[model samples]
Target: MSENASATELTSQYTAQVTADLERNTKEQERVGVEIAALQEQLASLQRDHTVLVNIQQAIDAVPVPDSTAPPSGNVPVPAPRKKAAPSGRAERTRPSKKTRPSRKTAAQPAQTAGQTAGKSTGKSAGKSAGKPSAGKAEAVQTAQATLVDLVRRHLTEQSEPRSAAEIATALGQAHPERAIKTTVIRTTLEGLVAKTQAQRSKQGSSVFYTAADPSRSAATARSEEQPEPADA
Candidate 1:
């Protein structure tokens, strides 16, 4: 009977020890799980920081380096760093004050003073009397009298075959360096002459060419037409 009691007591003590050990193991497992979670969060933060640092390094490398062989011009100027703006809620109002408008009487006084000054001044008449014929005015009068059509006609007549408008404008420019001639003006003038039957125009591909009309042939044709037909003979 005593042996049976001793065996039961030993079994109960063993069971209690096992239960205590299980409880300690459960608490240790919970602590380890929390540490693992904290480590994962730190790793994620470190990875994000590493990525940001790598991007900054790449941007710095992308900047161009100045040539070392070139001469240096004193100290390089550094731009001032911009200041950070204050929070919107904390910012102070900086609106400008309204400006006053000028009175109409003050505005009219300037005009009256200007008119009185003009009435007292007789310098304009003296300036007109002292003025002589300017060289620029004389040159302008000469250019006005010079006919561009006559010049283009002469150039076409001098050429053996048809000439392009660009060639004519270039020849005219070379002949009269003072005049600023354009190909479009020459082309318009050629078209005008073609309309008036004073010049012949031919198109070869995309180029338009001009030739002076034959005066002799035209005169002969006119004379033949003028002579009355000899009685149907």
Candidate 2:
């Protein structure tokens, strides 16, 4: 009977130890699963950031490179390079230079003076020629008589639908190749016209559009105002 009880106690202790071990293993597995989920979330975030960076890089790379040798617009002249000054020190004053200085009355002086005079005359003539083109441009502008605002009004009236400032400026440019029309100028003019009740303004998304006000309504209002109010009844 003592031997059987000792064996039964040993079996019970072994089963309890196995149960405790299984509980610890389950807890460890739960902790590992939580860590894995956290790591997966971090990995997803990193992937999203990586995609954004790649798209930005692609956009930057797709930009066109400007021509290096192309001259910029406008006839602004490039300045000449400055001449280097002679070194001022006591180290090399004794040695005579290989290049001799010419006297004021040398033949080279007369030739240089003549060349300088010719250059001055040429510069004056060029300035006069440039002035003529500007004068002609002013004359043409005066001859146009119709201001930019008038042009914009005409364009808006001609179109059945409202037009953006950029569209109106493009149309103005096409119609008048001699004029340099800017979208900003057109937008400001449209806004001014709106303030004056000459045009109606509307906005769609980020774009602003303009349309001519109804002339019939304005004419009717003018006529009503001009008519006497039945001598105040």
Candidate 3:
């Protein structure tokens, strides 16, 4: 009787140990999954930032830096000829020749006026051009704010049927060959969209598909089209 009781006690302790280990393993898996998801989101954010920075850097690099130190092309001044001092009582009435200086102030007046005019024109043109890039940057920021999830949502919106993650990734990859859009990332992004209720998922046999969720005001067009609408009352 003691032997049977001892065996039963041993079985209970083993079962309890197995149950505890299983619960710990499940918790650990949940924690790791959450961490991985967070890491992926951070990675996607960094990648988007990197792309924007590279574009801004390239735009900045494209602008030619004005060389402030270099002298203007043809503005070198000619030195005036110096005259010797006359001796005492000598006829020192030396008339400066017409060739010596040509109507100095009158000559420079038109040139200075023209220069000011040119400066004003260039300043206006520069101001106009500078304003353009700021507008472009604003547009770029607006576009950049549309992240991978938005893109996926947009793609789904464009489609009339449900799509698998691989198909979505392939279509995006084809559209933006420069971007290395992976199926796994697309799938994860889709899952995020699903969680937000921005997208919907359906299962057909072993295959799962996704589509953009309809607005609250409207019924799902895809489902309506694929399935039949009820006869109007």
Candidate 4:
């Protein structure tokens, strides 16, 4: 009786295991079916979009071009159409390709751009002859000189008197105490001003006194204006 009971328990366990495995397989199949359905739907959508694109391309290809040269009567002077190539039995694959050669007229023309180079050189020489200084160097010197002259003019206008190189250097030194002002530079600038007729130089013992010249005045008035104010009574 115990043997029969053991056999019956084993059969029941095997049947239960088979039932569980069948249920798991069915769930897997259902999941796979759902994924396949989604892929099919995506494929269908892509095919529809592709068909629409093809149709759009066909429509664009079919569009007719308007002839602007045609009058309201639709007649226009279009060029004669090229004749179709004659049908030949000499197999297209066997035909010898023609060699491309430049025309004799084009080949005979000079390649050296002599005219362009000559024009450019001539222009440069003319520019140089027109009292133009060396490009960057001359511009820089002129700019610096203008700035210095402007400063000196401002100083003289403020004081209503001409400044000696030493006096100008001293003032500059005080204004920019960190910078060194060479005596030579101040003297050169003063000489340039005198040469330009902006300032007049007079001898006073061994030292030279510089004065601003009045552009529109006679010599006597300029001399009188140069005198110091009289003492208070």
The prediction achieving the highest TM-score against the true structure is 3
lDDT of 4 at 158: 60
Q: Which pairs clash in the backbone of model 4?
A: none
- What Cα-based lDDT does every candidate model obtain? 0.68, 0.69, 0.74, 0.58
Mind giving the per-residue lDDT tens digits that candidate 4 earns over 110-223?
322444455566566656544332343345434332244555555555656656778877887686565456555556656655544556777767887677765654455667
Ten residues in sequence with the least summed lDDT for candidate 3: 68-77
Question: Each candidate's root-mean-square deviation in Å?
Answer: 48.1, 30.3, 11.2, 45.2
Tens digits of per-residue lDDT, candidate 1, 122-223, equal: 345434433432333444344442456778888988999999999999999999887677887677677666654678889999998999988986677668
6: Cα error in model 1, Å: 99
Q: On lDDT, who's better, 3 or 4? A: 3
User: Taking the tens digit of each residue's C-alpha lDDT, what string does model 3 give over 1-233?
Assistant: 99999999999999999999999999778556644674676687778877987887678557654443554344443445666766666634564667885676766676666666666666677677656666777777776644566678899999999999999999999987777788987887787666556788999999999988878623454455579768999
lDDT of 1: 0.68
Clashing pairs in 3: none
List runs of model 2 lying over 4 Å from the truth.
Answer: 1-143, 220-233
Which sections of candidate 3 miss by over 4 Å?
1-39, 54-108, 121-146, 217-233
- Which candidate should be chosen as best, given lDDT against the real structure? 3
- Best first by lDDT, ranked: 3, 2, 1, 4
